[model samples]
Target chain A: MLKVAQPDRPDALTWVFLGLGLLLLPVGLYLALSAPPDVNQGYLARIMYLHVPGAWLGYLAFFVTFLYSLLYLFRQDPRHDRVALASAEIGLVFMGLALVTGMLWARPTWGVYWTWEPRLTTTAILFAVYVGYFLLRGAIEDPELRRKAAAAVGILGFINVPISYMSVKWWRSLHQTQSIDLTTGKIHMDPAMLQALLFNLFVFTLLYLGFVRFRSLLAALEARKEEA
Target chain B: MKLPVEGWPEAAGQGRVGVVRRVVLLALRDLRLEVRDRAGLLSILAFFAVMLFIMALALGPEEEPLRRAAPGVLWVALAFGSTLLSTRAFALEVEEGTLDDLLLAPGGKEWIYFGKLLFQMLLLLPLAALALLMAAGLFYLPLERLFLLFLTLVLGVLGYASVATFYAGLLARLRGREVLLPLLLFSLVVPVVLASVRATTGLAEGLPVAEISDWWQLLLVFDVVYLTASALLFPVVMEG
Candidate 1:
């Protein structure tokens, strides 16, 4: 008989994860304090700092999901699987906030909240691809196979992320240009706005670490509860 | 690359079968199992019909445009539908623990993979023929491009079955693979789909093969890349 085992709880890493969680609160406040109103877009640009970092982290979180999914395949450990799941969940959170804040910011900036431009289109596809992964997981009954299959989906689906972006660029449509504007000598935002943006970036990264730890702990607890 | 054939216990135990009779006997047993239920033929045919019906409704009397679209439509529909069916070729074994039995038999997992791949390729042929008929009648596309179109479909199916079947092994062990298979497959297949669409559509537009050679070559390249990676990785992905 094949014996499948659960992962034991961590000691030092647990404390480190908790410490990172504690640090996020201060970092988040600094970003908000540092970010001043934009001379160009006014206070509205303040949202960009929160919104943009969230968008960047959204991709970052998903790629983490991909990496851990691969690691789980190699190690066959449930902890990595939980990490992948946690990253995916947090990625979604940030992605959602990014879109909502973008919409809110856009109501004044672009005169429209939703547009089918490449950024939006690619984002929509990313959203769809992940949703499909969840759906695929729901259909499987075996826990082990479920992890393996979902891992493959995580790896394969990354392909569309690029095409989804390229489709916007290739066809030449309504989507906005690249977000990282290096030209014009510098980013066209007020110093106050930059501080706030920077603060939000730090806050969110801390928040992400906190969430990943909490989620990992929950997964571990769930395992213990199941055993009991 | 040859392991010592010294003791059949350890060597044959490693999953290679030298006895022709034993391999043939196993193949016969597999064929019997497949024939007992007709699972492969049934699922592929069922989806093939559904795709044709939907395509007809979607096109709706636009025969000229339909003719050009037929190749792409057929290939995409076929690629997806075949994935649905071809995956199950080894599914029953996986589910019932027969897979372990086979793995412990004469040849190991690689032999099992080849057997399943071969079976699926054969099963897809008839469905492809049926789809070709539907494409011709519904879209009113001339069969004059039969050689080129069939060439594309054959290679496309070769690509589809090879990769799809390997992924099936990956999916076969998992629960809810019916949904996961298509998702994983479609992502990996975008490049192949692009090349196939280019080739089929270009030919459908009456462009000579030479004019469309670029797309054809791309499709061939994609097929080779997918096939090599799939064949090499099938063991690791499926077993490891």
Candidate 2:
């Protein structure tokens, strides 16, 4: 009888990256929060440090998923599928973080927990699409078929992201908050504040890479067990 | 490429004719199956009508509110109805294990996808017509812009059927997909639904065609984009 292989431990690189993220996160957070309150919005705008990077990484993770999904179809390798799934899972988590932080940011600024802001609405839809992706994966019993279907879903879902952003933008103009004018591609900020924001963005990106690598290993191990 | 196979004529002629023949035959096959088994059709239409009734009750019988809300309610009912039908779109194939048989016989996977989309559109025809009549009665809609309303329905139905047909095949092999289908489809289909409702509302309000053109254009773009994507991807999904 074939024995099921155990789930692989996160290797040295995973640990190194994760450790760097763990050590740097609080320092980055402190630096981000240390920026002086905005002249117009005051302290409420500080949430941008968390919210912006979270949103950027969220979109980045989905792009990675799309890339791997395309590669999976082309390469016909289960490893690529595993990477796509792991990236999507992490992407969804990042998206959830972005949404919550956005909600928190919106409350004092927009005067409501939610508004039909273009980015917010598009993010909500993105969240739902990936939720459906995981649901699809869970619903299918056959591993090979599930991977193929999921890769297709990943591709389709990514295609919708840009279209959703464009449609929502056309549906309404950017609600120009004090700090960011997404429509004009102009972000007004002091150099120190920008430094803090960029630092957190880097930290979050590294964290995303570490998480996906670890998750993909677990997925690969699971596939090995399934095969056995 | 010349095919030396038995019973097949000129390869170019076969390629050109085969696709149309396959699409029509598959569509007819599905339509015939529906006619033979009217239960699904009747139940789905009944469900649609009842939902409309419930919406009318919920919004109350007042003419002003009903008139303003009519387009949104109508599209909601249509969306729900089409979603119901799509969930069962592949039930027959799954039950009979004939989806594979059809795949094996296909000129291409796209023909099967288009065939199913055509069949769903045919099924929606009477159902949508009845829903339109019901909405007109319940909400006192004007008859002047009937053409635009009908156009919106056609485009809306086309876009919805395209996306829903793809999902139907995707989820056909999964367990508990009946619930999953709507959850996934409704969110992804927001642009189509939003554009349709807005266009219909503008028409109902007697707005000039220019005012509603944005929504109309959005619907057209959505229909073209989704219909093409569904056709291209359907084979990969069904085969996978």
Candidate 3:
């Protein structure tokens, strides 16, 4: 009952997501730039517009990978594995962007590009976990074994996401605590800044959705060509 | 003189205790094999000694620096040593072509995972203690709190081995697994290593139990999570 005849191109929804996300990106940027500066950090805080969304999507993307990986194990479906791979690849890029932007911000704010604080260390470890995920995927030659191994890595490696997210609160270390704490549902920022941040998050999520769909299609094509 | 698989049919009828017995028997069998083999065990021990000696030389000639660097060095040594051991967990099975035989046994496959994990703990704990003693000798690491330090060792090694055993099994049949195992393992076990190091440092620094308890709690959480997650996923991944 495997679905062999799949469409070669991304569907209408993928195009819509990519088109709308790109169209609204400049608007989101304008809002972030015009938003009132933080009382303490001033304009330096604007980087949060990019950094926060990047980190959020990174976490979101990995969570998706984790889910689809589980599904792949249970169902033995190539589509599920492809989705997991695409999500992980996208997650790595976004996580890398977040890390780079963070270092840029930290250089001016914390006097160094990197520090061994809890948040930074956990995030780096999280990044390394996915990098290993890709390495494991690449090293395996058998397709079924590769999918199984990658699924296991995808599931196990997700253990770091929550630890990285909560490291600031747990250690009370150098990193700033979440301004929009998900656990407490607390909003401790100016409304203007919050609005801009939320808009940027929405746009990044749209782009992530489009990217994953497109990447999965590319993966499916590769799989077909390998078979042919 | 029944083969392990020949006994599984009757053992499967025996339920939970049978599973427990199977786990222990499997672990002990592997342990017996490991002890008899000798080379793997001695090489790991020698690896620890040389590692600690070089680390001591690099950070030493001063007790204060050696003492300060002791916890980090000890745990890093243990981490590397365990990777060496973990690959051997399933290496012999694959080489012998008996892995498929083990899989062919009746009932849930989780016991295989637990059995391998137990073997790792049984082997790793003693080696870890010896490594701890070596660190104490060379790096001036304090031994007054030996019990607490050993507790950290158990929790940390369990966490590390749980994932390592799972990966070692997953990659057992693959070529280049020797290079790949550590690359996959070190990232996942960072939290365990970090907490264990912190706990050891606190004990060495003579911190009160209450302060170090936080690290112990973190290690325990990681141990439980890794153990549960690996056991649950092991069967699914190992299946065709």
Candidate 4:
């Protein structure tokens, strides 16, 4: 009979993460909502408070996925694979939120829900690649094979992310003359708005740190079940 | 007349010449197998033809629109066709259990990877020609940019094939990879697809060489990066 390995008990750091996330998120939300709106975009600009932070967290999550994947390949540790899997899952959720929020913001501003804007297009591709990563994980049964394959995808996908972004940028700029695209160049904001955005970014980073701890513990328990 | 083979260190002659020989042998074996079983090649060709016909119909009978859309249509078809080609390359090995045997071979797994990559490139050449012919016939494309178009296709397909072959091998052991391969593969190869379409479009429209150079450079950079990365990573993936 197969035996699952029991996950270790959660320690003080996990509790600390939970406490920080719980305390910071609501305060961050209060600041973001209370901050003055953008002069250019008005009240609608508040979406950026959520959108930008989510997007940053999404990128950060995938970066962690890439790091853990590389470590897994080098060290052949199941723990690294578990950490990679957890971060990728979180990254996908954040990216999906970012995409949706972006679309919502674009609707009133750009006059369309979707545009072939380089950033948007590149993010969509990045999101799809990770979705496929999860699908690949589901398709393989053997633990070692699955981990190796997922790590390969994770690493390659990370490399391709930048290449696709550059290609999209080149493709767009070459085809269309740079007429001051909405997302490019400089953005101006009131100092209060900047502070609010920074606070949210901090909160979201904490949320991600907390979420990954819980998720990895869940993964460890799952691995234990399989082992059992 | 041969000297005692044991006296010669195994590492002496088995350096570059040996790796090259192994790579060539593996590539030829795949190509030979493909030749013997023509179903895979024929199906892909058939798929290419049908895809072109569908594109033709979808764009209607207008020559001007068809001609303008020709570059995009050609590359899109090739991208899908190459997906099928690469997936089949590994799927056959997986089904036949030859993958394990190949992995068991001592050293030179990179040779096996290049072998598959070479096999994919070979199959792509004729398929691309056929697709080009279809585009020319259906879209009424002028042959003025044929040279540039050919170069774009070669580079674009090389980049696309290298990456696709890498993933195909990676996913070959999994169930339901048929669906997952293209999903993951297309996302990663978006750059290759975009560059190819743009470069081909520029050539077809007689854009200045200076303007087209950007696309050419992107394609070249992508091919170099992906090809080298795939070569280095293939051994690790196969070892799994």
Candidate 5:
């Protein structure tokens, strides 16, 4: 009655992705340095230019994934799951970026590369949660059950987003609270810093959209293959 | 094999009460079987007790560190013990083909999910309560925070039960359900795990209520969020 994947629908996506794929590094570099030097931390907090945005966008992708997962749960349409899986994979990728970029930044600023600082620890846990999500999905054989299990994790995993957002306030930790979110930090930023942060936020938001669309397109293609 | 959602429409259109009643009834039946067999409850309790006992030996009678760790140890024990118990719930059902029949009953896939989750909480709460008592008494903590302890256990188990039940349903189609169940369960329960541990540990340490309020709030939020999500996601497992 319903088709899970329809790969033959078109090849337009593949070409568009190829073009975008070539452009990632240059755009990433542009966003990385576009921000001004931090007065407090100097060039180091500049790393926030990348880490914060990656974490922000990862949550955005997963947040969207959470809603569509509900749709899959509510509607029982495999396509919704395909979209969610796509989003989660990208979420996972961006989480990794957040971690890596944060590490590179942390090494120069925080002295030691890591601590169980609430924010960093919570972010790490989120990554583990999603990695475990993909692992559970891969281990299961029944396709429908795989979708269900992943959706369950998708929803559970996102619950961490708010906690991550609030972790600094929730627990005393070494990591400085974000200069932005009202939950943890002093909410004022110099206009230039705020401008750079806002710009990077927009760029990352665009990046997330591109990644999810591409990943979902790939999911649709993968489903089409299974159908074939 | 019949799915639980395909049964008679006797309670049709009765709204929330009817739905809740059906869910409670389903959970009650499972609980009865569990009690009679003593398999689920005994196994879960045995696992929790044995693990706690082992940790006591490992950590020695040193009170300070043990008190610091008491909350986390108890939660970990309960999480793993219930994982073992609830994995068996569906494994036994699938083996007996009862799960298929249950799946065919009246209601949506969510009723089955909610029922199993409720049954899990019922199954684990007492054992968790017992373990918390043993740990508190042995560790020689002031017994004044029993209410707080109770609150922590309720919210923690609620979170764990919801997650474990969802994974059990998901893992029903896979072999080696026991191993896969815990792996899937804890991987997703970190937020709950964090909130619960902090709440319990703070209570054990006799921290002021104002200091630990954040964790309590976090636990409540986690329970609501995960339960709602897993309840909604139940249908996906059913379709598979």
Candidate 6:
């Protein structure tokens, strides 16, 4: 059952995360701007600072949704469902950011804004899956059924994240391979650029944490109002 | 209406064989009902014919373009047509208020998902074959490799139906499910569609089986993953 007794305001930790992330965002930008130019693409490659973090956080957020969806199914808790919903919503925003930034980067680099390469295609499908998640949530009138259905989508849709991440390796497409390959624990990036990218990733992750918490709190309030 | 599945109550108690029997009974019953109610099946077949004709007309009278387009056109039609049939899988149960009864049956609800999936596969496979033949004729698609093409159909249809049946069951009670099903389905099953289309094209091109096996492997992976995930989730989602 949903606990309508949840606190109405975002917690202190949320404020801290949001503040720290906001404080660091500009610094991250400065670092990204000042970072060494790519040996090939030059300063145009700076988009990776935003694009990589946005995509990574998108994957992370969806993974969180997946975990919470599973928890909701096993535990039958509306709180878990709310978290899943909030995370998915946040994930969509970050993923959209990644896609747009990637396109901007691609036009100057790959000479086309879009290609049907595996990584791009898989990522687009991943985006659509979450979009459908929200659509499903909106169409259902019953809260319980809506939650169950959304959870199922959340779980199933996360399947594409790994596929999207690995599509570069699997298909050897036009999209460049990961600079920081998680599977192989390899780093093929300059230390200064890697540092800036890592910092941006950290800041973006903080913002994501803050946003998800705030959104989930709002969802809790909405759920409480719906019950009232 | 009385539950069409005979001996379902005792069927669960018989262990491994019982689950298999229950699945077959439910599937066969649905198949019989679907066949008896010819309207849905006829419309889907008609949809395939009309769609293939329009596609051929739009892209065609030219052989090379149509041949290249055949696999994509065939799979897209199959994907769309199956959504119509997929909804019908649970629409009858929901209409008659028998879905709850099926859920209330004595054992695990996984079989219900499997049964509905089997029903979709059974219906879609033959229709797919017919659509393939239609494409072959209209689009200059080669079918000298009939057996390989059929293999592609089975793998592809299973991949598509596994997710479709699961989603149909999920959205069964909603008013706007018909519209929503395809939206959700197309996104998740793109890989399956992509692999199937590629495999079909390879077969049509007279590629070696070794070349086409990669696509087959991909389709098999999707089918197995979707089937397992949906089976596990079905009972949880269906429960009140």
| Fnat of candidates, each listed | 0.20, 0.49, 0.49, 0.78, 0.47, 0.45
Q: In model 5 chain A, where is the ten-residue run with the lowest total lDDT?
A: A178-187
Instruction: Report residue A161 deviation for candidate 1 (angstroms).
Output: 4.8
Worst ten-residue run, lDDT, model 6 chain A?
A: A178-187
**Candidate number of the best lDDT:** 3
Better of 2 and 5 by TM-score: 2
User: For model 4 chain B, where is the 10-residue window of minimal lDDT?
Assistant: B1-10
Every model's TM-score:
0.71, 0.91, 0.90, 0.93, 0.80, 0.90
Q: What C-alpha lDDT values do all the predictions have?
A: 0.67, 0.80, 0.85, 0.83, 0.71, 0.84
Best by DockQ: 4
Report the Cα lDDT for candidate 6.
0.84
State model 1's lDDT. 0.67
What is the per-residue lDDT of model 3 for residues A67-160, given as tens digits with 9 covering 90 to 100?
9998898888899999999999999999999999989988877667876655567778878989989988888888888998999899888875
Proportion of true inter-chain contacts also present in candidate 2: 0.49
Off by over 4 Å in 5: A1-21, A27-46, A74-77, A163-168, A173-210, B1-9, B13-25, B35-43, B205-214
Q: Give the DockQ of candidate 1.
A: 0.17
lDDT (0-100) at residue B240 of candidate 1? 34
Q: What is the TM-score of chain B alone in each candidate?
A: 0.83, 0.92, 0.94, 0.92, 0.90, 0.94
Candidate 3: C-alpha RMSD to true structure equals 4.7
True contacts kept of 3: 0.49
- The C-alpha stretches of model 4 lying farther than 4 A from their native spots are A1-7, A177-180, A183-187, B1-12
Native A-B contacts reproduced, model 6: 0.45
Q: How are the candidates ranked when ordered by TM-score, highest leading?
A: 4, 2, 6, 3, 5, 1
Write one digit per residue (lDDT tens) for candidate 6, span B93-167: 998899988987876788999999988888888899899889889988899999889999999899889999999
**Once model 4 is optimally superposed onto the true structure by TM-score, how far is the C-alpha of residue B38 displaced, in angstroms?**
1.6
lDDT of 1 by residue, A6-114 (tens): 3465445544645764676566656665566555666676677678888988888888888887778678887787788777878888888888887897777766776
**A146-175 per-residue lDDT for model 5 (tens digits):** 777777777777765675456434554322
Per-residue lDDT over A40-123 for candidate 4, one digit per residue giving the tens place of the 0 to 100 score: 777888888889998999998998999999888788878888889989999999999999998898888877788776888889
